[model samples]
Target: MSSPPEQHSGQGKTSDRASSGKMAPNATNAVSFFNSTAFDTRVNALINEWHVPGLSLTLVHQQELHSKAFGFATLEPPRNCTPDTLFDIASASKSTTAGAVALLVDDEENYPHVQWDTTMSKLLPDDFVMAGDSYTNNVTVEDVLSHRSGLPSHDDFYFSKRSSHPDDPRTVTRNLRNLPISVPIRTKEQYNNSLYTVASYLVEKLSNKSFEEFLHERIWKPLGMSSTNLQPDKTREVGLGDRMSKPYIWKEESRRFQVLEYEQTPEAQGAGSVWTSSKDYALWVKAIMNKEAPINDEIYKGLTRPRIFSNPEDDDLDPFCSWQGYAAGLESYFYRGHQIIQHDGLISGFSSVHFFFPEFKVGGVFLGNSENAGTVGSGILVKEIIDEILEIPESDRTDWNARQHKQNDEYEESKKESQEKLRKELSANDDGLAEPLKLPLDVYVGEYWNIGYKEMVVQIKDERLYIDASDRTMAFALDLEHISNNTYFLGTIYDMLADGEEVDKIKVEFRFDANNRPVRMGIDQEASLDGQLILYDRVEESSGQGQQKVVVR
Candidate 1:
């Protein structure tokens, strides 16, 4: 691997004060720390170890923004990643959605009916209905934005190709009624992207503009974030495709990074679709930190105010963070006596994190085009910077790189053990018979339909059964490896799209009627909802073609 080259903005001059254990709270001091050889070595080491193709870092100190870029953005043509390179911010877009809603709430003269407490049903009565009657009637903008709406993240219902649902915000919001509510209202903070989509839909209803337009007019334009947009294709349209960082995933078996196709999620506009460059995102973070225009005091407070525990159980385990809570769109973490308001975004092959210290008026943004960027790489760099700023003794500073390596090793080991256990279970036959499947493979091949997750087609090819989506994108297909009787292991194909290591090998079970005919297929798409299976009933043939066995070979 080639060494990552550095590109600095040169906004702040390097100071010799960085050599001390702690630097004074100033932009120059912060720049000095960032420019120091020690910091550069640590960052390069982390990037090389994590196999990150490209990384963009932006720092905020004393209201000044400093940014730098490292590594190759595109490997095939050998293009260097610059600070202007655009990357998908993923779930980090949630904060912007919340900010847009806050802008609407501030417009009391025009949108008097729109408030944080205003029920979603009142905003979009025709489309924003929940599963439960009470939830449908009472859920508020705050409830959905804070993720306390009692809905588990039914992400697969929308992201999975099996669902031929329309890629519009209103339609997605309307489909929420068909999903199951896994918890009671306001009891737990379950992160549901669907609710964020509903929030985006609410933005559309109130502003009388598309979510993208609202963001551009209110937030992006005002903040001078010209590079920020809601779609990747927009980058290509504007003749900046070469500046867009290609997404990549680390393949453990091959010990190399593999590129992946851009995950186009027009439906997840508010949840995770914002794409921008480090240069543009720095202005955004700086605005939030300095209470700049468009992000007024009320908006900032609404965006950062802690409403519920994000993960109360894990509070005691972290050495740096004492408490953590989920705010409207952002997250609050009390790290080492400073309140850090932040959020992290992760999608297929992109990860990003933006965080700031309210007390110190310091913040940082890390955007990388690889899976480990936000999960492991960003955390290490952020903590290291925080330690330097806070004047923590070098001996007391935790070895985040080592800590992350150990944790990652343990996680990979556990994943391997689980996969082995699943393999053994799938191979075992209860009756000890050579024929594991109770019915012929042809009998199980048919079209299954569900209201929330449209149609799934099972077919036979090369004498083996396979399941695929009707509106398949990226050519998604899974093999039906027979486990025993009616159950089969959904084996995903090892392709460029699938990282292989994290592929969800969910089980599929076929339900047969009294006459021993397959009637329904049960799949645990929403595994977070207590393992409840989303049943897809068989789609019977039309009357004209009735009683004809369909086979695809």
Candidate 2:
């Protein structure tokens, strides 16, 4: 459980602590923190070695602050991580709802079927229940937060496709309501979006208001968190979109975080969709510590409980992802005598991480515009800071390199497995059925250019259709359906279609005539052009016809 906030006597402490976080420790008493002398140097080294962009950390020990800002928020702009920089804290948002519901339960009657007993039927829209399954009939609110809901991480039905159903605004929650259950409820652990998707409804059901409206009036306004919010309207924008850290993703080959657009607009309440900065989020961390205020102990425990036990796949994307220490809302990792309560957030390009140790009352928050900055690496950095603060041993600290190595190995294996699948699909002629591209080798060769993208040259090298286009070089086996003469569908994100059926494969519209003559064409539709960013015919197709004299007839 989170510790109650102590009352500050204003006893010769730093003035900055009072304004930043009532619980912030005095900077003058930095010596009181573990090995205060070598702290800053260690923190800097970690960021530099990791190739992190901008990061902000605030460590509170006995009503004092040990906070630092490092690197640039944007490399070219030379924007730095300041005390006020905001970040998109992704899944870390699970805890906020956990905390909010816990606080509401304190004043209101306990919600109906809120615990594990309350199945998805009671919480989600009627259609969400699967046609043939009964086990999925009992997923609860707590189960959702804990990720124990036996739902598949992704359903082929929702495979990157958004439903245009008009009953509700398109959201992950509504999607869950319509999805088939992948596994039985509570039988095995799968990080289900359906659970948290339902949690948004529960928040609305119990709070007597929409989650956005409810949080704005109840939790946010009360806490004086002037900046934190869900939707940012640039017209009326203030702290919501202002002073925001530009989100970036690390380019492994380029060795830097590349700036990208923030695309998530959450109509649902929870499920890691909210946005806020380190400056405003520090208020939230302080609120979690202050049990005497609106945030109480009941809320703290709810937010920190172990929501799931064993996972068939322990290293899946979500928290509760690991078997050792993950719960509904917070991840539980052990460090010597202390069990850390933590959460991390990821949305589009922005990332945020929050960590609190209930033991020493030493907790910190990290926010970065760059997704690369706040992944497993962010967790290690926090533990490192905690070790430095509390004088904890290296044994208690996280091994960043080891953890990174494991993550890399897993990613590479997954990638190779994916590649193999793609290799097989291209050679097939049936729906998921096996057939190779029926065209002759030379027929597939040409400089293929469509409306928007740069030229993609098709060459037959090693008896394969080698495609070279904007920053990405791809090779497909010569086995693909001969669509007309030049156009062929290249399967999903990582594979090529085998079964002759479209099966929702991306339409690789070839810019060629029936006779296979090359022609420049235009592609206008909602496609995720880059970084999973949904561009609504967003980017203009490059014009190869630029400056050509029209001389129209």
Candidate 3:
């Protein structure tokens, strides 16, 4: 990679504040940022504000390394963080397996002619009831490795006491097996830690070696990552445990960070639970960037290539993060034509961030023992580092991390304005409840269809109003609210007002007929039009109880 927009050659390792003035990172070639002060100030402010334990940052600029340390490793006897402080890398471990797969595939030593057709059933016991057929069975090892397994995140599965069972992983594995997969293989990208958990077994079946052994032989030893290890729960008692940083969550009432740990997940063994330091991870990043050295760029290219695109959601607050979309193992986005491969780690309280800019040949890793350390988005952090090193515009380096927030803010403003307009409009209307025109709950029973556009029905059985349409059905909440004399809202509500600056009113309205019968209709003021639910009522019920024919009126 070229040195920024300018040409600065002598700009690496020796470029630090405490160390030197002569070999400072050349400012001539790139926008050499002195953000260590600003960044440190911001970090300290965050630490004091959030009461985070420890955070370690490793920034590599043209082979120059800068590591900054802060805070205690734990709450009790709070120890100051050292440059060599070891933090649990959390799910950041996935990228390791991803890299291993890339290496294996590149080597083609025993790589199979895989697709989205391979079966876990063959690998495991027959009694295990995982969904899908030969199509899903044929799902390639690549499919699982890339997290395109078409299964919802198996997180809830871990809440059960069975999930925490020691020695036996089947408690967790059983939940994954029983999950009914909705999307078929190659249909949609779904993140599944369980599939990656099974990846260990997959590798073992093919290579006749444990996942640990394979990684050790193929990656860890080769990269000289002596510090990195897949910490097993069995050896934890014998003092052979990876030096771990337990996670923490903010307790508002107590106003202190509480230790957060998963009950049975340490035994999960396969998908997550790995530990190392920024210094060690720098070597891993360096190896990845300089792919030709050991694993070769072929493996690097396959692993880093954009297989699928995704927009990951941010959980700045709250205990867990919402679904962040998948981009193979690594997430990618163009920062002004410069592509970045990144991944984040979340194991309750502990958080880790890693991002690599392939174009600039630069990467950064941040391990935070604090839960809320993710407040500063990774994209901006990585870009600022890249921009400072390579002298690029910060705007070009910043990410779309703030996009959703901006959009949601705009939507909220619009909604507020719309609400004000609605308040004015409602006041303008002189109609009050002259008569409620309400009907008996049971009278609104039996599929009431709007006749043409679609079908929605209120099926009353055992005194419950169920909205039925074909295979889909939703029961109306018992506490129905009467908005107007003739209008009522049920279940979920949405206002379909026109573009701003008008008497904002519900474009889609539901109101009963003169007969006082509850009807499914959408109105934009003039007259009620049949809704989608009306399609199911085109025919009349002749002789069956609660079974009516559709007759689009």
Candidate 4:
């Protein structure tokens, strides 16, 4: 992995600033430090050592923004990642969504009187019903943003859902009450994307605009984030689509990065789906650093003010971050006695981190196109950059790189072992029943309904039994491989999960009536945190002639 030529966004202006010799003292120091050969060596070494395809980074100190790009956007084509190469920023999109909601709350005309403590019951529609204690109904907007709404990170509901399914934010909010609460409301903090979708919906309801539209109007367009957007379709439309970094995951067997198909979920946009480049993201950081106008001061303060302790027990254990707490959408922590605000974003193949120290007026954003890049690479680079900015003494660059390589090596080894075990188990049990098909394949093809989830339609498409859980928010057309008896394996989803990935696997077991006609479908979905098998009853017609046929014994 040779070091690719770095591209700067505003080189002409930056040169002028440098020549003018009028830069703020802190800005001058930051520019010298980040551009120093030592910083470049560490960053390039990390990229090469981790097999990262591409990475885009931006640094801001004392209001001066510096953008840099490294490696290939596509390994095969060998397109270098530029300052404007877009990468999905994942969970870093949270702050923008939260900021959108805050902006709406700040609007006098729309929200005459609405605060973070405002009850969900009052803000949301009458139909929304949260399970658990009476306290569940009293959850506030701030509580949702801070991950204290008694909900765990039920990420699968978003990650594994059908792409064709209606990803309306309102629908996400409606399903919240159906899931069990992880803890008593306001008692503990649990980070999840579901509530962010709910909060984004709140923004939509108040502003009478889509979350993306609100951000574009208030933040993106205003801040000059020309290459930043919530939708890939829009990115393509602007001709920046081709510049987007191809996502990749490290394959243990191959000992190389394997490219993954570009996947976009607008449904989870609120939680983690924003595409941006280093150059574009710098403008966002500039907005935070400047806190210029109407949107800045109020929204920035809300986004950074600590609302709940995220890791109270580990405050002393981790030397990297201390006094950890969850703010609106950002994590507020002290790094080496400097108040740092940050968030990390990890989707399928891309990982991103956006961190800033308000007190020091320094910030950095990193985007990488590899799975390992998101898991550990970004953190490593951040530490290196921070050390330089803080001027730490006798920086052990060699030791740092060595430890990072060891960590990644261990991860790959563990992943390989996990995949091998899953493969063997799946193969061994694939024919466990050794029984013939009990009924016609058509008997199992019908629309099954689950109240907790929704409709799962099993249909024969192109002469193959396919389950379309589009209504359940799963975009994949699950091909059912007949394993044994009435059991079927969802091959497509299962394959990805076998690789130690996050794809949800559904093992479908068709329950039959006395005459061997299917009456109910029992699906073991990976999304269920408690490992409960969800049962969906086959829908019967009014004429008494339907997929569910009653046969009395």
State the lDDT of candidate 3 residue by residue for 1-553, as single tens digits: 0110211111212233222233334332222342345666655655555455667777654455566666655555454455456676666777787776565556544555332234555445542335556533565656666666566553323332231223224444444554555566656666667666666655555577777788778877887777676663422543534345555665555665666443234334456666776766766776776574565866676667655434344334211122333544576666444566778876556778777777665666778775455444352355455556556555554433354346557767987776455434333243322234355556545553431112344555454333422221111112233344444333222111100112223332344546655444433221112122112222356677777564424
lDDT of 4: 0.68
- The 0-to-1 C-alpha lDDT of every candidate, in the order given, reads 0.75, 0.51, 0.51, 0.68
Write model 2 residue lDDT over 156-237, tens digit each, in one string: 2221212232112234454554333445555556654435645766677666787777777767788777777764442126
Score every model by TM-score.
0.89, 0.66, 0.61, 0.78
Write down the TM-score for model 1: 0.89
Give me the displacement of residue 10 in model 3, in angstroms.
24
Provide the lowest-lDDT 10-residue window in model 2: 1-10
Clashing pairs in 4: 161-473, 161-474, 162-473, 162-474, 162-475, 163-475
Q: Per-prediction RMSD in angstroms?
A: 4.6, 12.0, 13.2, 5.7
Off by over 4 Å in 2: 1-37, 62-65, 109-116, 123-136, 155-178, 234-236, 254-257, 289-292, 310-325, 389-399, 402-406, 421-436, 439-553
lDDT tens per residue, model 4, 103-222: 766776868667878887778855356765474568888998999887777544543333445556777787777666656777777888878888888887877888888888988998
Task: List candidate 3 stretches off by more than 4 Å.
Answer: 1-35, 49-51, 62-64, 110-130, 158-177, 232-243, 261-267, 292-294, 312-327, 377-380, 387-553
